[model samples]
Target: MVEGNNSEATKFILLGLIQSPELQALLFGIFLVIYLINVIGNLGLIILIYIISLLHTPMYFFLSNPAFVDLCYTSSVTPNTLVNFLQEVKRIALPACATQLCCFIIFVVCEVYMLSVMTNDRYAAISNPLLYTVIMNRRVCIQMVVSTYLYGFSVGLLQTMLTFHLSFCIINHFCDDIPLVGLACHKTHYKDIKEVILFTLAGFNTLFSLFIILISYIFIVFAILRINSAEGRQKAFSTCASHLTSITIFYGIIIFMYMQPKTRHSLNTDKIASVFYIVVPPRLNPLIYSLRNPEVKNALKRIIEKVFSTVK
Candidate 1:
């Protein structure tokens, strides 16, 4: 039975993106721009998808979901981090810290599973083109989405519970207030174990999903190569290029951060990597998908034209 300290620490101060004032200002500006772009781009994608009946296909369907998830993903971290940069003291309460951590974990896990589902969608389109509609129908799509959220939420609950359950007795300083690794102040030997579990879950989900994507692409590439017509091969390759680019960027940063030795787990490094997952990917995903997709571009153009015409 863990005893409660009613007089326990309430809040924690977050060391923003960087400690240097110049760097903080610079980073704040950069991230602000990125956040704006992320929100605009993703929101545009969602709107375009909804308004344009032509983009009701499975690919666009999955793309829009990730765009939404990415928006939430970036929101979970960037806003708070940005605010902390401006404030003299960036303090968060214990409940807020727990909430942030849980939210962050949930969105990230969702992104991972969503990417996997997107890869599978692509695989079906390429490998079983004739039955793509039947295989990835609305029911199936809904199930995939539901499962992704369920898996993410369940994993997040487990991790957050395990992490906060430990007693923070050893450190006299603020344990509850610090976000991320700051929660480790408890004389908990479970830090290593917790990290291992997190790494295992994230790593397994990412690597396994990546493996499926790779295998699917292998088959897809083979199919494309077998196509005698240049146009057919070109179309197939073009369809996959955007997904490949997004996946590479997403997993590249994740693997780089997690696959490293425990010795490399610095707070600054982790924060930077977290920025990649939270800020950069969300900003880039909509651009990548929209720029590559003709239907989306056309819809966006129409929407912009209508907005300008209305203002006039």
Candidate 2:
């Protein structure tokens, strides 16, 4: 039901992850748990950041953006994926599938830039602590966030336009960009060019964001090394440690999944990669920050105590 001249298919049969009923049942339970945790952890972090004034610094402000993105990003895929595990023919309406792909592009782009912005925030906080407040004022923080969202929206719209032009006579997997391109009924004239453009957009964005992160972290490492006190150095590294871990896991999986040309990509392998890429980051991000970050932990503790006292 895509309102385009190119779309031929009305619905896509999502051959969800695997065909094994037994494995599907098992994966259903596993992913249900993961989705719940992803929801609670991310929403909790967002609410905590909103309510707790102590965490109103530039770091937490940037942190909350990713949490919100993770929540929406996972929601766009996981519920439908979970349902696909229960039924044999996992058919998604063309409109819904198109919406899924658009949302995926939007949030993934937002997340990539959000991570970059966070690194910049960390660089400012550690490299110039005295001027941190001046450097990341409220207006500047809002502008950076607004810019990230705007860029993401633009890319999502552009990519969605390009993708929906394909006449999907047959769809053999989830409504992801890679799988859709791979399984699209490539009888159209622009198929090859479109695929090239799609991959180029993905690859270019990945490298561009990675370049920003790499340069920011390099400056961060030098600034941390210059600190004389061992405690000062540890504190500085600690601030970035959670972000560093999250990025390593995120970028490592993303690079493995998307960097390959479509010919080299095995759908089976890509499906596994998709699970890790989609599920793991949202689940682990909040845990990494909450468990490792003193501020988040203290804020949670205070909120818990207040709730208990009010109940008593």
Candidate 3:
């Protein structure tokens, strides 16, 4: 419990997911597979979107950024987690912990808003199919994408600055705001401020984005209902199916992890929930999008055929 004049603890030990040696090896293997899938799936989605001209719509344009962000988001945490699983002492320096926290905030915020924007895209396309092109024009899409990343970076910087200023007595679990606050030394003003900042920032980001998603989907549901033909209704819903699945899994886990009272949270449960949000979503999103969306599926088939022909 050492403290300096202006510095918190320089290094904090991370108590990883499990303690048993045998289970550690098994979990390590499982997470390795999960991490690899996350990487390949996300990268494949990005590359597929880029090379396939058919996917060059506002929907896929919005889709690609999440793929990129998920790739980065999982990488920032999962690899370190893998190494820690194998190590005797899973210690992380304050700077590295800060970096992980920064990246986590940046991508989580990006993911939150990106889901909202994608929902809006769906609403625009479904509610006004004739003018979908004009509504989601290239300039407008570009602005939306830029704003998502900008907000993410801004929040990341603000949160990181506030968090690292506090003196931590000890730290365990992965580098996340709630757990970090729990382990921080009981410095009244700094602790209070950090908790408030966490609540405000996380609450606003989640709720604001969720509000947009809710309103957009309500309109989308009505729009689909208005279509006279059953075929027309199905076609409209098919477009949004993948995005909706993504939003469900993502937001469900986020709310479960963060929106609860502190008394209700256990570090072990938080660790498992963290895996679902961080590692699982990246792998699942690509599958959800590619499997459900016809455009992406067709493009993937074309690419596979082309590659096999080239080999022959």
- The better candidate by lDDT, 1 or 2, is 2
Model 2: lDDT to the true structure: 0.88
Per-residue alpha-carbon lDDT of candidate 2 for residues 1-312, written as tens digits (9 for 90 to 100): 233564355777777777899999999999999999999999999999999999999999999999999999899989999988898878898889889889988999999999999999999999899999999999999999999999998888888888888777555556778777776665566878877888788898899999999999999999999999999999999999999999999999889888976668977887788778889999999999999999999999999999999999
Supply the TM-score for candidate 3: 0.95
Q: What is the C-alpha RMSD of each candidate to the true structure, in Å?
A: 3.6, 2.4, 1.6
Write the number of the candidate with greater TM-score, choosing between 2 and 3. 3
Residue pairs whose backbone atoms clash in candidate 3: none
Candidate 2 segments whose C-alpha is farther than 4 A from its true place:
1-7, 187-189
Q: Spell out the clash pairs found in candidate 2.
A: none
lDDT value for candidate 1? 0.76
Measured against the true structure, the TM-scores of the candidates, in listed sequence, are: 0.89, 0.94, 0.95
The number of clashing residue pairs in each candidate reads 2, 0, 0
Candidate 2 C-alpha error for residue 52, in Å: 0.8
- Model 1, 187-241: lDDT tens digits are 4567767766777887798888788778878878887788788998888889888
- Alpha-carbon error at 174 in model 2, in Å? 1.6
